[model samples]
Target chain A: MFDISFENAKLFKDCVDAIVNLINEGEFEISSEGITLRAMDPSQIAMVDFKMPKKACSSYKVEGDVKIGVNFEDLSRVMGRARPEESLNLKLKDSRLEMTFKGKFTRRFNLPLLDIGGTVPKEPKIEFDANIKLNASVLKDSLKDASLVSSHVVLSIDKNSFVIEATGDRGDVLIETKKEETVVIAHECTNNAKAMFPLEYLNDILKGADSSTVITLYLKTDAPLKVEYPVGQAEIVYYLAPRIENV
Target chain B: MFDISFENAKLFKDCVDAIVNLINEGEFEISSEGITLRAMDPSQIAMVDFKMPKKACSSYKVEGDVKIGVNFEDLSRVMGRARPEESLNLKLKDSRLEMTFKGKFTRRFNLPLLDIGGTVPKEPKIEFDANIKLNASVLKDSLKDASLVSSHVVLSIDKNSFVIEATGDRGDVLIETKKEETVVIAHECTNNAKAMFPLEYLNDILKGADSSTVITLYLKTDAPLKVEYPVGQAEIVYYLAPRIENV
Candidate 1:
């Protein structure tokens, strides 16, 4: 039996939002340290790594390291029912997931558990030549602008600036941020790097990142791109496979 | 030549929202006094009457009384592109409707005017025994609650209270506001009145009404229900035909 309470449910809601777009089912590993979920999309095009520290919860308790399988689409719908200022209480009982939002009225949702029938995907190990930290909004807005022009965007970083560009049949969008720009918090590059990835995956991952949040990017030439951001006390990392030519 | 401007486009946006669910196309009558639109849904089950006085617009102009037909769906989409604090400018160029939202960047939309081949429907005249003014939220909340149970709601008023009720196969919802409740502003009922109207129409009409806004209801036994509310310097009225049991 496991029970946990959050001061505000927004963090968990955002965590579920980050995964519901690409994954249908996954398992949450609850341990004394915190909760961790790592999964790859069915298409093998992307992977998600999520972690929430136990200290983030107002109250957290666990008997042992337990893995709970959940259908993220249903989990997101249940989380959407929470109020802005309401506290969220989650309880696992009799193979059912029960969520209660403490508001003027005690609203509750009982959801069925899913059998993932598999283990979490192993995190791929790769070396990167460029690591940059910037404001989440800059990336989000750049992705949105690129989406208006094409389905995929090229993420490029040089010694001077970080760039996002998209070209389509009708138009193209280009966004560049130099290190001097306040939007770029930190930058380190050993060599210039560029990689093309599906904009849809990046767009979905940005859903949980707010404007003021800080986002870090790890990239290498033609290698997978990793985007990381923190929500409350939790950290979310997404790895999007680059769109190689001739695929 | 016609040109008009608004400090904030929210009034026009809300106006379009009030009718877009029911009426697809309609004519806007621009006069020295302000702007007015009246149309009936294609199904002939509901009619929308909208009015915005000159005082509502930052600048109002009309060479003469001019009528321009517009597709509300397109207009609503255009208005949605406006930023929260952007000013709105509308001009009639040839047969095209040009709308510009002035913000950090001027965003413009050019849409073709539809040939709304007919004149506006004549307004219906009916007598009612009850004219009650109450907090718009009471009505809005009641409709939302009823929608969770059924597609239609029964609105009733008598000497003591205003009641909204809905019954379906699973469960039922009942919301009642008595004279003692501060929500009831000014109520006059000479006799009992009851009418059944589709909840979808009522729900859409209440979208623009905030909690502080006043909503006036006109009712009679088994007759169409009339709902009226104010947005800025404008007044909007909707007439929804009642579903008679034997009709």
Candidate 2:
């Protein structure tokens, strides 16, 4: 039997929202330690990795290692129907995933599992020269401003500041956060790193973020950018490849 | 000069939200009394009528009778950017409608006027045998429940109760409000009146509805349904034609 419960259904819903856009379907490895999922998007331009430890849940139980493949869209629809104050219970039964929201009224949904075909992807390897940690709201707000101007945004880090810039026919937006701003938790850079990535992907990834949460950014010149944030007790990481010019 | 200022931008925004879906563009008549708009949906399935009296605005000024054609979608987009606490000022200048939101940051948008070719529709006339008044929330919640089952909803009123029903392949939902539900403000019917209307149009008209808001329903067998509600000092009314089965 595999069963886990969360006191806050919103947290579980949020965790699913964080990765559902990046990957349509994913195989989750469930064990006594935790539940983990890592996959690359169909276009191979982005990768998503997440881990929710057993302790993150109010109650977690498992008999052995179980691999479950799920269609993210179906799960998202089920979560959307859940009330904010409801608690959630998830169970794996045969080929169906059972999700139950317990509150004033009990609502249950059975989601059909997809066949992932046992395709396992290796961990992505990348080197970064700059790491900046700041408030999630800062990133979220900057992304919104960027989206108004362009479909892609440029991220660059200087010695003491990180900047987000977007240029379009409409207008250009530049948001710079210095080290003195309390929003910046840490700013470390051996050398300046700059990259351009799609703004829509970042906006989708930050949909569930609020001002109180913290996000860390890993950047390298002309390489993929990594954004890390926490969902409940789980840690979600996303890597988006940069757009190359005439390459 | 034609200028009107609102103490609360959200009130004006809500008024536009109530009808934007059914009517794309509308010709508004500005006079000493206030501003009024009457338009039918492109498909002629719904009719929307709105009146914002001079008392509804903090200030109202009009030199003479002025007719301005406006695209509701553009106006709605501008309103979406307005904060709840922001006050709004609207001005007509040289065939352009200018909207300004006063808040932390003053944002201005100039929307171009459309050429409606001086066509004004006469007010719709319908005979109704039944009149029902209920809390907007009850109707809103019932429509949401109905939408889950079907795109069309059946509304019927008998001697003692009002009923809403939707049946689809997925399932069927029936909501009945007894004469003493407290939500039923007034119900008068000489005979039973039953009709089926598109749920989406009704849903759009009630998007900004709250529990305290009262919505009056006028119904006739196989005839259009008339829903009237208040937005601030303005009275907004919608008439939706019934969907005949197998026609």
Candidate 3:
């Protein structure tokens, strides 16, 4: 028997929200050191990596490594129902999983762990060509406007400016804000790169972000886009598959 | 040519919200003297009757009887997008209904009123038998809890007690709060009566209630029930058909 507690439930909420947006479910391995799992989606389009260390918890008590495949959608739903003021408890009940929130309510659900198909392996450590730090609120606002006009958006970054553009049958929307325009930007990329990506997936990954949260974006030409934001005490890394342009 | 300006959009929102919940999409006759509407849904399961006098507005300006048959639903949707801080302009554009709200930005939408059936017939004045005056907030809470257990609720009143009961396949919920149980027994009815009404219909009528705004309920056994709540400067009366129980 082992127990760990969090001062706030939002940290867990952000992690679940970010992962659920990227993948419906994934393999999670909890060991004596910490919990770690990394995988790319079916199309080899995006990869999601999660790490929740024991030291991050008030109590980091563990005896062995347990690799459990969890359907984050189901777990997120259960966690979503938890009241803000209540403390969350996770435990094993026979073969089912038990979650108790507060001292008042408890829910038990069973999950089947499947052998996640062929191991496509993780991405190679390639240095990102462009790195930019931006406010989540600004990016969120820009995405909202772009999504209104198109299904897929093209993001362009230059040494001095970052641009988001979406054009469709309805209308065209373009949002460009420079580092020196009003906000601070320290972009070093001399050349410009553009890639198209789905808007729905991007919006979902930013669901739990607030105005004050800093969103760091990493990019390379024709490569998966990476968006990283910290939620509560957890760090969430979201990778999105790029849409191929018509030749 | 008709134009009206409201500094705060919420006044219009509150009026539309209360009006929409009580009635189905129907024709509303707008004039310089007052606005009037009366119609029953196609199914005849419910009926909504609305009236707003010229005295309710800041300026009572009119020249002719402008009977524009407005679709309540379309008007509600347009009103839903108005922000409270924005200045709202209601204008007739080329005889087409248009509303422009100016906030951080200007957003204009056009809504065409549909021809709904029926006209507001002269209401036959009737004296209500029993009246109970209570805060809208208190009643809304009671209905919310009772709805959790059943779809049909029974409302009863004794000499000094107010009782609400709802029972379904799941379980039963009962709420009994008396005048003496609190402090105020403004009026009491010695003859006790209970009437059952649909929960969803009741929910609609109570949607725009303000906690501080008092709601007066007029009830009669085997007859329709009427609930009157105050909007900013107008009185909204919601009439609902009651379900009869065979003794």
Q: Provide the overall lDDT of each model, using Cα atoms, as 2-decimal numbers.
A: 0.83, 0.84, 0.69
- How good is the docking of model 2, as DockQ? 0.05
Q: Could you tell me the TM-score of candidate 2?
A: 0.56
Angstrom error at residue A104, model 3 = 22
On lDDT, the leading prediction is: 2
Candidate 3, position B121, lDDT: 40
Ranking by DockQ: 2, 3, 1
Better of 1 and 3 by lDDT: 1
Number of the top-ranking candidate, with DockQ as the measure: 2
In model 1, which regions exceed 4 Å deviation?
A: A1-210, A213-247, B145-149, B167-175
Q: How well is each residue in B1-247 modelled by candidate 3, as lDDT tens digits?
A: 5666667677777888887775656665668767666666455555556677766654444556665666666577657756558777666666556666666445455555555555554443545556688877788889999988898899887777778899988889999888676423254664666689998888877888877778887776656777777787666776777898777
Worst 10 residues of 3 chain B by lDDT: B181-190
Deviation in Å, model 3, residue B223 alpha carbon: 3.5
Per-prediction TM-score: 0.57, 0.56, 0.56
Pairs with steric clashes in candidate 2: none
How do the residues A29-50 of candidate 1 rate in per-residue lDDT, one tens digit apiece? 9999999999988888999999
Q: Write the per-residue lDDT of candidate 1 for residues B69-89, one digit (tens) a residue.
A: 887876676565556787988
